[model samples]
Target: MNSPEQVPQDDDAEVVEPARPRRKGIYALPNAVTLAALFAGFYAIVMAMNGRFEHAAVAVFCAMVLDSLDGRVARMTNTQSAFGEQMDSLSDMVSFGAAPALIVYEWALKGQGKWGLIPAFVYCACAALRLARFNTNIGVVDKRYFQGLPSPAAAALVTGFIWVMDDAGFKNVSTMPGMPWVAAAVALYAGLTMVTNVPFYSFKDVSFKKTVPFIVIVAIALLIALINLHVPGMLFGLFCVYGVSGYVVYFMRKAKGKPVSVIATSTDEPDERGLH
Candidate 1:
């Protein structure tokens, strides 16, 4: 018989190592939120197919809200999982990538013939690349800034234009004089910016759980009221500013000689080449 200090390797010796616990079933609550977002994305695609472009745009926005909530909820409840992350990424690609690309293509770019499809495809492709890069660079990229115009922001840039234009009495972008070319420009701009090296503030530093003065709540209420007063105008204006905000950040960083590129220097991860 082997002494207690002498670890026995014989098959007859009783194995004493601790048994590893089996993983429990997937956590439900946070992933439920992710599924809800996925449903919203699917709803957007269906609505777009039905030619109710306005409803589709709203659904995409709803997905954005739901998507934003899931990660936070996961963190708060200790329910984060690989499944949830993968689901969220897939949902974002549909909601923010394919959905916006198709909706805009159907609504406006379809009129531009072959040229229109080009920008829409570019937008869709860029959104995919952005999401993939985001997944691979998690915990390596700076939390305060995104490496590029986020896929959602790009979607908002594209769809916000649609929403505001549709609300502004232009039922079809092609109907407006010179609007087809303009829509094409917007699509290309939103797409290409998503893959650029410029940085956009991620707002990750803001802790939702932190307590603040009563005035902050008051400010939020005021903002909500403002949005209610002119929903399309307000939202479109906000996203328009955000669509161009990365360049503003980039130039400001250059002026101050601060780091303009978001690539983390000390990470062991391989660089994503050819992204511009």
Candidate 2:
């Protein structure tokens, strides 16, 4: 605290303390985007409850897109704030964590009775754990590779399966032979993957502002066309590949006898544990 000082104006003034300025309030734009993402996640859950699984899946995917944009927009606009960051994390939990778990459970797991709830709860819990770990280890972890499957990607993996099956005219997961079993496996896999030590590509090194060759643009165009051909199947397949890519990295590292940890340094996170 600042010590009170006396003014010597007329030798008759009492001492007074200086007033401190108030801290700034939260930013508007980034937080607005974060709230929109949160709303999308909430909408997905609500839709799932109403038996609109396809819409729910779409809503979760929408949340993922919006979640990705909020951070970039905040950074680009110079509006990044602690409030925005926290809001983003919370939004992600709802969007990529809880929403996917609930939606998938409603679509498939609910059919398996109590057994179905196990993977959903595990996934939800793992997502929470993963997000907490991410927040605490922001500067201590590797940037090019995520320590585990990202929550958004995990959410995408589950939601994409729902979208693909729903689009294929499968009215329910249990009706399809082995679909419920497959979905349960996906849930457990995605959930467990979130808390694993396996390295998944972060794509952080891919800079948007950097110049690229002409073929890169053409390739992107072609990619868009391919996706347009079959949105659900293509998206699900992409996320499935990404979902398992972490294991591929882990096995590759193991085969080479390299230290497979994703944390920046051994001392940085001595307690770091992941599935090898």
Give a tens-digit lDDT track for model 2, residues 1-276.
998997558666786989886565688888998999999999999999999999999998899889889989988888778888888899999999999999988998887889889989999999999999999988767777888999999999989988998999888675566888899898989999999988898887799889999999999999899999999999998898999898988898899888787776565553344422
Model 2, residue 146: what's the lDDT?
85
Report the CA-based lDDT of candidate 2 relative to the real structure: 0.88
The reply for model 1, stretches above 4 Å from the true place, is: 1-25, 268-276
Give TM-scores for every candidate, taking all chains together and pairing residue i with residue i. 0.86, 0.87
Clashes of each: 1, 0
For each candidate, what is the lDDT?
A: 0.84, 0.88
For model 2, the run of ten residues with the poorest summed lDDT? 267-276
Compose the digit string of candidate 1's lDDT tens values, residues 1-276. 765686557988776899887575588999899899989888988987788888888988898899999999999888888888888899899999999999888888787779889988999999999999999888577667788899888888888888888877787665567887777788889999988988888887788789999999999999999999988789878888888898998898789777676765646642432112
